[model samples]
Target: MLIKYLGHAAFLIRNVEGIRIITDPYSPTQGIHYKPIDENADIVTVSHEHWDHNAVDLVGGNPVVIRKEGERSVRGITITGIPTFHDKEGGKERGENTVFVFDIDGLRLCHLGDLGHKLNKEQISLIGRVDICLIPVGGYFTIDVKEAKEVIESLNPKVVIPMHFKTSSLDFPIAGVEDFLKGTERVKRLGSSEYEIEKDKSPLEREVIVLKPAKSS
Candidate 1:
């Protein structure tokens, strides 16, 4: 499976069969200056109703959009939406968020969509085993660097991809990815936005992989 970062919290995940899935398609009008998401996908997952994360109309191809929490299969890909929050105060401050888990090409990929708080025992149990984790490390609106480290320890994914942080295009009051990578070991700066995961291959010793935004201005 191939995972391409489309800036912010959005990602385009494609399996070997060419089934494409997009997570948290952001809106350029919401002060996020990243290039518009004009790509096509078979499935689109919206984590919340926020303008920056739920611009379903921007995506082409008449894709099937998943917005709620549950288990479903589309085009032979199994996805489970685990209910979460956009704030630590149980959605009172911001709103509810859905963490989407995709089972594609014999790998379990988890996308934490604007996750706000640390994971409890039940949420971790529901998420099950994660191979690749797409997490948000920016502080103000989501979990900060400290909390992100704790969450990573909880999920224990083989590969960690940090997203939704400060970038040149984003104007949100969030910390840059550098804040999360400070003093971190086994960090691989790919310099590109795309990464391919082989099912039979062993996990990388370099756990944290940073990818440049694919849709920057």
Candidate 2:
């Protein structure tokens, strides 16, 4: 499977069967000076209704969109959405959030969409074991560095990828990825936007892979 970071919380996941899944397609109106996502995908998973994450119309093709919490299977990929919150007050502050877990091509990939509070034992148990974890480490609207660390430690996935942090294009006053990388050693800076992962050759232990964000166009 190939995972490409499409800036911010959005990602394009493709498999050998040509199945494409885009997560949290962002809007250019968010003040990010980049092109909008116009590619076609087989599926789009939206975590919340926020403008930055729920611009499903921007995606081309009549893709099947999974925005609510439930079990869905499409093109040999199994997805489970667990209910979460965008803030600590049980969705009173921000809104409802969905933590999506995907099982595709023998790999379990989890994406925490704008997750705010730490997951409890029940939520973690529902998520099950994770192989690739996509987490939001920026604190202003999501979990901070310390809280993100705690969450990563709890999930203990073989691969960790941080998202939703500040970048040159982003206008939010949130912590950058540097703050989360501090004191961390098991990290690989690919310097590129895309990564190909083989299920059979995946790591046995946890490691962080940092990739450059792909252009919005």
Candidate 3:
């Protein structure tokens, strides 16, 4: 499978069969400047009804949308959405969030959408084992660096990809990715936004992988 970080929390994931699944497609008004997402997708997952993460209209093709918590299978891909919160206040402050777990090209992947709290035992159990974790490390609207590290410890995913942080294009009041990478060992910065992973080549230990934003358009 190929994972392409298209800035912010938006990502384009393609399976070996060329099926595309996009997560959290963002609108142009989300304080980030980039070429609009013009690619077509077979499936799209929206974590919440927020503007930044639920810009379904921006995506091409009539993709199947999955937003609620439950199990769903589309185009031979199985996905499970675990209930979570957008803020530590249990959704009272921000709202509910859905953490999507699925398999693509034999690799189990988890995408934590704008998560703002540490994972409780129940939440972790529901997520189960993950090969790659797409996490949000920015504070204010999501979990900060400290909380993110805690979650990573509990999940113990093989590869960790941090998202939702400040970038040159983002104006959100959150710290940059550097704040989360401090003192971290076994970190690999793939200068490009895209990374390809296979099940047989899964890392033996936890590693943080930083990806640059893919050129928009």
Candidate 4:
């Protein structure tokens, strides 16, 4: 499968069967400043109703949008949306968030959409095994670096990809990816916006893969 970072919390994942899925399509009006998302996908997952993460209209291909918590199979991909919160206060501060788990091409990929708090035993049990994790490390609006580390330990995904952090184009008061990378080991800087993982072929271990945003500044 190929995973391409589309800036912010958005990602374009394509499985071996050529089925494409886009996660958390952001809006330009949110002051994110990432190049407008113009990619096409077979499925689009929205974490919440927030303007920055639920702009399903920006995506093409007349994709199927999944926003609520449930289990569904779309185009041979099994997607499970676990209800979460955008704030630690049980959605009182921000709103509801959904952590999407995609079973594609023999791999289980989890996208923590603007996750606010640490996962409890119940949430962890529901998520099950995770091969790849797309997490948000920025603080103010989501979990901070410290909490992110704790969450990573719980999920224990073989591959970790940090997103929704501070970037040159983002005006949010969030920390950069560097803050999350500090003191981390086995970090691979691909220097590109895309990374490919082969089933059983790629080294499936605890490694942090950093990729540049695909969208131009």
Total backbone collisions for each predicted model = 0, 0, 0, 0
On a 0 to 100 scale, what is the lDDT of residue 133 in model 4?
Answer: 95
Q: How high is each candidate's TM-score?
A: 0.98, 0.97, 0.97, 0.98
Lowest lDDT sum, 10 consecutive residues, model 3, at 28-37
- Which residue pairs come into collision in candidate 3? none
- What tens-digit string does per-residue lDDT give for candidate 3 at 1-217? 9999997899999999998999998886857665677879999999999988898999998999999999989999999999999998999989999999988888889999999899999999999999999999878899999999999999989999998988877778899999999989999999899999999998898889999977343
Against the reference, the lDDT scores of all candidates come to 0.94, 0.91, 0.91, 0.94
The lDDT, on a scale of 0 to 1, for candidate 4 is 0.94
- Candidate 3 versus the native: TM-score? 0.97
Q: Write the per-residue lDDT of candidate 4 for residues 1-217, one digit (tens) a residue.
A: 9999999999999999899999999998767899999999999999999899989999999999999999999999999999999999999999999999999889999999999999999999999999999999989999999999999999999999999999998999999999999999999999999999976865656999998989848
lDDT of 2 by residue, 117-191 (tens): 999999999999999999998898999999999999899899999999888878888989999999987899999
Candidate 2 TM-score, C-alpha based: 0.97
Off by over 4 Å in 4: none
What would the per-residue lDDT of candidate 1 be over residues 102-214, giving only the tens digit for each residue? 99999999999999999999999999999999999989999999999999999999999999999999989999999999989889899899999898883756389999999
Off by over 4 Å in 3: 215-217
- Kindly indicate the candidate among 3 and 4 with the higher TM-score: 4
